[model samples]
Structure formats: C-alpha cells, structure tokens
Target: MQECSPPAQVAGRTPEKALLSPSRARYGEGMSRIDRPALGILLICAGVTAISVNDFQIKLLSGGYPLHQIVFIRSAIGLALTLVLLRFEGGFAALRTATPGLHLLRGLFVVAANMTFYAAVAVLPLAQATALFFVAPLFITLLSIPFLGERVGPVRLFAVVAGFAGVLLMQVPEAEGAGTVSPGVLLLPVAAAFLYASMQVLTRKLGAQASAAALAIYIQTTFLIVSALFFLVAGDGRFAEHTTNDSLRFLLRAWHWPTPEDWPLFLGIGAVAGVIGYCLSAAYRLANASIIAPFEYLGLPLAILWGWLVFGEWPSVLTWAGSALIVGAGLVVFFREGARPRPNRAARR
Candidate 1:
C-alpha cells in the first residue's frame, strides 16, 4: 500500500494544482497517507448525494414532464457542460472515433441504462433502486474476468454472492408487503447495472485512444439526441396512446418548472452534479478501477437519507440490515484491491 507519486499528468501544471490541489498530486508519495483516499471517498460521497438529489428531483418532476423530456433536458444541459470542458482538450473533432461501431453500441447501452433505471425509479423507492443498482459492481467483477482478462479470486466471488444476497434481502420485505415483485420492475436495475458495467469496460478500452472527457461528451450527446427523439415520438403517439406507462409522463405530470423561487435547488443540482461528474472523471484518471469502484456504495446511505427526508420513504429495518451487508461486501472488495499492487505508472493512465 505504498503511495506512489502523481504521474506527469500533474507535473509543473498550475491549473492541475488548482483543480486537484497540490495535496492531491502528492497522493503518490504516501506522505499524506490518509488524504488521497479520504478525498476520493469524500468525492464519491458527494457525487452520490448529488446524484440522489438529481434522482429525487427527477422523480418529483416526472409527475409533470415526460421521462424522455426530463432526460432530454438534463442530458442537454450535461452535454453542454461537457462540451465546454472539452473545448480546451479538443472540440467535437476530439470526440470523433475510429470505432464507430463501439460508439453506436455504447450510446445504445447508455440510453437503455438511463431509461431502464429511471423507469425503475418511477415505480420503486429510491433506496430500492439504488440498492439493486449495487449489482453493477458484481457485474463488473464478473465481466472483468472475460473482458479485462483479470483473474477473480474466491474472496471476490464471495463478495459478489453476498452482494446479491443483500439484493434478495431488500426485495423480500417489499414482496411480503406488496405481493410479488414483478420481474420486469425488479430486474430493470439489474439489467441497467449490467449495461453500465459493460459501459465501464468499454470506457477502459476507449480510454487509451480518446480522452475520458471526450468520451463522456460523446455519450451524453448521444443520449440527448436519442432522448429528444423518443420524447417527440411519445408526444406524437408513437407508443400506446401516449399512456402514463412511459417514464417521461411520470415526471412532466408531477411538478411544474422551478421558478425564480426554486432557482437555488435547480442551481444546486446543476453545480453539484457538474462537479461530481468532473471529480469522478478525475478520480478514475488518478487511480485504478478497483480502488474507486467500492466507494460507489456511499450513494446508498445518501439515497436512504434523501428518500426519508424529502419523500418520507423510510426503508424497512430488513432493508437497513441488507444495505449494511452490501456495503460491507463492497468495502471488503475495495480494501482487498487497495492492498494489492497497482499497475505500473505508464499503464495506469
């Protein structure tokens, strides 16, 4: 667990220092043993909180706007922000790729992941949706074996199993209270998690040829376009008489646009979410996937808190216990990975 020095990515750079701070650059020296990881964890926590608030807002907004409409708005804003950040690196040309096939598939997966997960959120509690999405780590663990050609140890396998068991624990209580959970509804997060895991793997492959920011911009732009199209079609009666079954309708019908009075909340979401995305990209650049992967569980507690405070949706005691186990399993995997040797410097970035 020796701290390595930050690579040339930050060397002699003023903006880098201002953005990540000098202490962050010193993460490699192991001098400040606790700082880097703590920061990484804190960033993860903040990212999750921002994301939960975003989800909650989307949920409330769903009642007023169509899911596609809301996604279109958010993605449009997100993509605009991403493009502005990418201007320094390169413009749209920087995001161009030789692998158009992968880009197409990646976009499809990204949109599908959003649609499915949002649909799930429209039906299930925020905590439940968040808990089920935890399966993405397990999916990542398994996918890495064949895709990344990484070996999966028995302990990691056990962690994955324990994670799934936690999922069952969360679900069983809901089933008992509200009859059987439909496979379609319950499995949306599972499918989205798997798709997201696949997206992560794809990003690793794409990471070498293209900058992460460029890739992110491309994906968000893709989603924005697709979402706009879907929203238009839905509004035009492409689906079943534009029923409320679609996610976009759920949001649009729920809440009116936040006026000047609600600008604080809107700005809070935009600023926090924009920064979270930036921090997550920076973290992925600084460290290996394993080191940052487990920290994603920080979202669970944040989601639970937000759910209770805003929506008054208290999770059952059983869910609380299950969430604990899942978090524990994620931590075990994260800590185990941290203890292992990191790849060489040249290969990490």
Candidate 2:
C-alpha cells in the first residue's frame, strides 16, 4: 500500500466502471502489443452497448420479478463466469490485498448504486433513468475535490453546474403520462449516481492494489449476498401486497423461477455482465479516460434505442434537452482533464 500513492483525481477504472457495470480489476498482461488507446475506445463503445442491453432486460423483467430475485440469479451466473476469469486475472493472488476493508466498502457502494438505479428503471422510462444516472460523472468531479484533494478549475466547475442544471431540467416529467418522470422518481438514479461516484473515489484510493476481476468478485459476491438476504425476508411478496408504490413493489415482490422464455434473457444478462467487466477493466487501464470517457455517453442514446425498440419508450423533448447538457458538460470535463498536464513528482520533493 505504501508503494502506490493515491491518485490526485478520481482515477483507476474508467467511466464505464461507474456506469452500474460490475467492476473488474485489471492486470494488462494480454494487451501489450496493440495501440492501447484505440483498443480502449473500442472496448468502451462495446461496453456501453452491453450495459444498455442489460438494463433493458432488467426493466422488462421488473414488472414480474423482484429486484433482488433478478440480481440473485444474474450474480449466481456472473460469479461463476468471473471465477473462470479469476484464473487469468492472477487468481487467488489478485484477491490478496492489504486493504480488504476498502474492497468491502467499494463493493457496498456499487451494490447501493445498482439497487437504487434499477429500482428507478423498473418504473421510469429507460432513457430517463439512464440520463439521471450519467450524473455520476458530475458527482465524481465534485467528490474528487473533497476525497482526492483535487482543485476544480472554473471550466470544470461550470461543467459540473451545467450538468446539475440538466439534471434539474430532467426533474419535471412530460405531460401526465404513466410511468413517466415524477418528483421523487428522478432521485433514485441520482442517488445511485452519488453512490457510484463515491465508489469511483474509493477505486482511486485502492491504487491498483486490487485487480478488476478481484474487485468484481467482491461486488458480485456482495450483490449475491445482499439480494439473497432480501429474498429470505421479502421473497414471499407479503410486504408488497399492500404497497402501491411501483418501485417499492419491485423491490419487495417475491422471487419466482424464471419462465422458460425468460431463461435466455437472465442467462444473457449474466454473460453480458462478464463482458462488461472485461471491456471496462481493459478500457480504462489501456487508454486515457479523457480520450475514451466521453464515449461512455453512448449509453444514453443506446438506452433510448433499447427503450424504443423493445418497450416502445420515447423520451420527451425535455428529456432530450437535458440529456444533451449532461453529456456535453461531462465531455468538457473529460477533455479538460486530459489536456491538463500531470504535475512532476520530482518538483514536489
């Protein structure tokens, strides 16, 4: 731990890592020969697409299944897949870390983020949930100042302001539509964004002591344990019978065996979880986030596409305008951070 100094900014892993995708620590042994940044960009694009699909499937099943049930199933499959990946990610040694407490904290943060975001997704349109979730980056920018001791320039501050303004814009739901945005519904993903941003700061503090897969194993295991506990207590739907809140019902509903038709979707979600872990670990490690981070916004449009094609969802014009500002503000921050020069270590001494 003494050998690795803390990152001055929210560093380690990429934007995709905090996008509610599972976190996998990286060991960069395989991608040495290729152009790292190019590959990183490609991986990010692919990763964001996978996240969109995973969320879509979750949204589809939320009406019929409890949040914990779906997560429990997905994690069971995902953990097995990640165990297979662990062998390549330095195996048991990767899991050996002096900072086990930090790992535990990171895993909890991710679980908190996932639960809040998807709870919103179950009731809100996919585009709107995702749009609010993208605020994680803005959170990272703001959190970095306090957690990482980084200074925010005027440009980054403005970006953060504009991003929050966009979030406020997204708060007013269009028309009196069912399942559209509402006063409190918008806060679910926003809360998730805050938790995810906190997780990113912890990732920075971890300082590469943990590998991607190892960190993911922690999160996946945490998710499994937490979801299972939820099942033990709430799997019978007893608590949900009286609840009128759709989001609360989604969380409190009983678990059920996936129907034959739903099996493939569950299995696919697990498989995509694995793919997202790899793509993200390889991406942020291989390229400068400034170069690849903006592309993470691909999730927004992809979410829109998935919502429309699968669920017939179309975001309102207000949603559209808000999405643009959030994405644009994040882009400004990413480019500015990339262009800013790294301070010399020798000069500090």
Candidate 3:
C-alpha cells in the first residue's frame, strides 16, 4: 500500500460541497423549539378538560355515593399518580424540604378547593358551577394587594367589578314560583370559588421553588386524609360494605350504586379524567396563569352541552345571558392584560 493522500475529487462533488454538507449546514441553523406561550395556553386548556371530566365522573357517582367518598378516591388516585411522577424525577429523597409547614398549608387549601368544587358539582349544573368557579381569577387579582404588595390598577379594579356583576347576574335569587335561578344551589359554587381562588393565589406565591410534582403529591395526600376523616365522622363510612344495591342505597340515602354492567362508564371516566389532569399540568407550566385562567369559562358552554347530551338538562335564558357576560368580561381581561406594557428593567434601576 502506498502512502495515502487527501482525495482530489470524490463522486462529482467539489471540495466546498463536501465540507458544507446538508447535515453541517443544518447544524449552524438551530432547531426551532415549541413556543412557550402557546404551550402555556394548551396546557391550561388541558387542565380545564381534565377537571371537567373529573366533575362529570363525580356527577355520575354522586347519585350513588357521598361527595366526600368520591373526593377521597380521586385524591388518592391523584396522590398515587403524583408520587409515581416524583419518584421518577428524583426518588423520595427529593421530597426532603425545609418548607414542610408551607407545603402542609398549601395542601389544606388544595383539599378545600377540590372538596368545595366537587360538592358544588353534586348540587348544581356543571355549567353553573364552572361559571361561578371562574371568579377565582378576580380573587387572585385582589389577593395580589395583600400577598404580593402589588397595587390594583383602575383597569384591573374595573375588571374585578365586572366579574362580580357577571357572577351576580348568573346567580340571582328566584322570586316566588318564578324559578328563574336557584341562588341557593349557586352558593355552593360561590363558596368553592373563594377557596379555589385562595388556592390559586397561594400557588402563585409559592412559585416554582418547590418541586411541582412533590407539591401536587402533598396536596392530593392531604385531600385524601381530610376527605376520609370527614366521611368517617359524617357516618357515611360504610360504603366499602356496600356489596349490594340495597346497601349502596342506604349509603347514598336516595340513589343506587352502579351495577356491574355500568363499570365501563366509571372506567371511561377514570381514563378520560386521568388524561385531562396530565395535560392540564403540562399546560399550566407553559402559560401565564392570569391569561389562561379566563378561558376556563369555555368550560361553561362545554359543560352545558355535556349536561344536555347526558342528563337532558337545559340552561335557562338568564343562565345563557349571565354566562355570556362572564365570558365576555373574561375576554376583556385577557386582551387588556396582553395590551398592557411589560415593565422595563431600566425604569426599575
């Protein structure tokens, strides 16, 4: 073999063409990543769908079981799921933290938020409950005053006023035989709204310092524990003994447990709801909470459609008008937020 030398020409390619190959040229031009803002919006939408499906399942099971029982089961499942994710991320040692008290407090709020929302579903139409819950964003805005020391601007204040008005319109008291609205049933969502809003504010205040997966695990675990205690004391703890429809009947007071034939429906609920939760978590991380919070109202229409299709319940004219107002105001806030100028670092300095 003779001493080798660099090839003068290979195939029909020039020296420059050989050096500037397709892969090398492409490497200099970086790959485009997913848009963070778009990702955030998608994640928020996913979260809404997940919670909606979860509510649907609760609605189905509510007739046959106490709301707390369903909450307990869901929370337990969520906790297990979260723990599994946390383990995959970094094992149990990753959970060791100095903010145990804060974690516990946040967990309490999560339990309250979930339980209240679930209870609302048991008493109100899914649409109405969802609409009322959308008020949490306004609450978060107000909370910024005390918690974050942020000043509430006139525009945001007006938005808050409009939001409360929309809530009032959706939940006005019914006059004698008028049957216009069930203010009492609506109260459930209102109470839920307050707690849910508190939860949102607290979550923001905590930020991404704590492991989100771990925080989720703690919240779900707390909910399970609290729900179990509540049910045990409420004297509805015998659901596990419900081997027959008759036993289930006594547990629910007026409804019956689903027969074996209906197991598919429950399983469907679990699968759909599980997917929703996972998607929402991913979305929540990608978008601005304030911006994405409003589209949650979209769930009102979707829930109403679901209610009509599944349970044959139609919303009243007032309900429609109120929902429109709430959604419209929410849109206003979202656009207004986007229009506002982001702060410049030079000004702060």
Candidate 4:
C-alpha cells in the first residue's frame, strides 16, 4: 500500500488500508496463514525504522542543503528502485492508468503534503512534529464519509472527536517543552495532515487501475519534477539570505554540491525508500489491516526515541497526553473496523 499515504507514516492506518482500492476491503487479507501476521508485524517494524532513520537524516541535512535538492536526489534514486519493483506487480504495464488526471492530482497533493510536514520537521522536534501529523487519521475518518460513502458509527464518531481533542491539547505545550515552533509555523504539519488525508480520499475516485509500485512511481516522478523546478528557479541561493527562520531557510536555501562524507546518507535514504515501499507493499498484501494498524502506532514512539537520541529533544507532558488520546482513539477505530466481517479474495474480485 502507500507509505501511511510513502513511508512518511500515517496517523491511524496501515499503509495497505490507506492505499488499497476503496472497493476492496480485505480485513482478512492473509489471515488463513499462521505465519503471515507475524511477518507483517516484522515488516512494519522494519518500515517504521527506515522511515525514522530517513526522517532523521533529512532533518540533519536540512541545515546544509535545500529541501528540494534532497528531494530531487532521493526521488531520483527511489524512482529507479520502484521501476525495478514494478516487475512483481505486473511490470510497467501496471502504470497504465485509465484516470491520468486523478493520478496527476494525487501526486501533486502528496508533494505539497510532504513539503509542509518536512518544513515543520526542520524546525520542530521530530516527536512533536510527527505526533501532530498523526492527526491525519482524524481527517481521514471524516473525509471517508462523503468521499467514499462509508458510514461512521457512533463509536468511530466518538473516536474522531477524541483524536481532535488531542490536536488541541498539543497546541499548548508546557513552558519547558522543546517541541515548540512558531504558532503560525505549527500549522504546517496540520496542513500537511489535511492534504495527506485528502489525497487518500481523492484516490478513491481513481478506480482500481494502478498497483502500489506504479502509484509510487507516479509520486516519485512528481517529486523529481517539482524539485527540479525548485532548482532551476532558486539554486543560486540568492533568496535564502532574506530569512533566518530555519523552516523557510530549509525550503528556499540554495543547493550545494554534495560532499563525499554526506554522499552516503543521500544515496542510502533513497535506496531505503525503494526497499521500504517494495517490501511493505507485499507485507500488507499478505496481512490484515486491522491487525497491522495498531502496530503502525509504533511510529510515534520511534519518532520520540530518534528525537531524543539524535537531537536531545524530549516530549512535554502535554505532548504525551495528546499522543495518548490520538493513538488510543485510532486503536479503537482500527479494532472495530477489523472485527467487521468481509468476504474473501473471490468475493472482492
């Protein structure tokens, strides 16, 4: 499936739930097999780790390189890896989309969402930025109603309300909290969450034409084009001297030639992006979303650990309180949805 909507991390869903065709709800995807669920958990654990490391390195490199430059290099490598992985799904033909316009629109929304979230990451503590971003589950829960014609029961409705309260709680951290960013800047992650959730909803309109690898290829291509455009317009770094804001600086700063020492980080994240997408794509296909969804919450703790280890940042009391609410609400929803009965692969076809 999609990366929690690429390996970026989702608020409340397994990557499979977010990216799978809206018409197909395989709550029991691989349940017939005993080993499958364990494998899925292991794959998600690996995926979360890759995403954490990737995010840490991106934040590390932000001070030295423009966001678009890093995106360009990362996407360039990831695109190649996705192309090779396409073989498993049915080759390049899987990319054939009857709804090109929908694909284009989705790719652009994903690009915008990533830009804002990373912008937040460059300035805020990784744990705080990620915790706030997990609000996407709230957004998706609401969006699915009108968009996918799905009904939200009173239980899920209550969960959405609580998850939203979590967002409000995080808005005012303790005085000693290190996760604080400018109030205006804090909105970036929320905005990204909205866009990411909206992208998932919009995908329902796309029909079941493209495979996960093919969809990833479209997104990487979008990243490549958008980053290239950023370079052509601002590679000179002339515009960067105007601001001292780290997030702005990260976004508009001039590109630089890669140093030998940093080359490995740049190349390595891209490779990891490819493998994460390919392997997790299969992992979800072989597992159930309900069982997998709770584990996906591991991303939050992983974010907290990375923030502490790499940047010496710690979550405030409010951050913890808010995360608990959001995560708890998401689990309720996932468990309920998972318990619902559904037909097997034959019925889906």
lDDT per residue, candidate 4, 190-265, as tens digits?
8888898788666444433345677678888888899999999888888888987888889999898989999999
Q: Let me know the TM-score candidate 1 reaches against the reference structure.
A: 0.76
Candidates' lDDT values, in order? Answer: 0.58, 0.72, 0.53, 0.71
* Candidate 2: tens digits of C-alpha lDDT, residues 151-237: 889999999999999888887645212234456777898898888878777776444345657756777788889898898899999
Per-residue lDDT tens digits of candidate 3, residues 298-332? 56667877777776767766667666665665566
Which numbered prediction scores highest in lDDT against the true structure?
2
Error (Å) of candidate 3 at residue 258 is 6.5
Clashes (candidate 1): 22
Regions of candidate 1 where Cα sits further than 4 Å from its true position: 1-43, 90-93, 173-181, 205-208, 237-273, 341-346
- TM-scores of all models? 0.76, 0.87, 0.74, 0.84
Candidate numbers, best TM-score first, in rank order: 2, 4, 1, 3
Give lDDT tens digits, candidate 1, residues 1-349: 0000000011111122123333222323112223345565565555555676777776665444556666665665666676787776555666666677777777677677767787778777778777777676567667767876667788978988898888777667353222344556767777877787777666554432344456566566676788666755554434544554444345333323556654554555455445545456545554544555565666777777878888788877777766676667667666665565533322333
- What lDDT is reached at residue 197 by model 1? 70
- Angstrom error at residue 159, model 1: 1.2
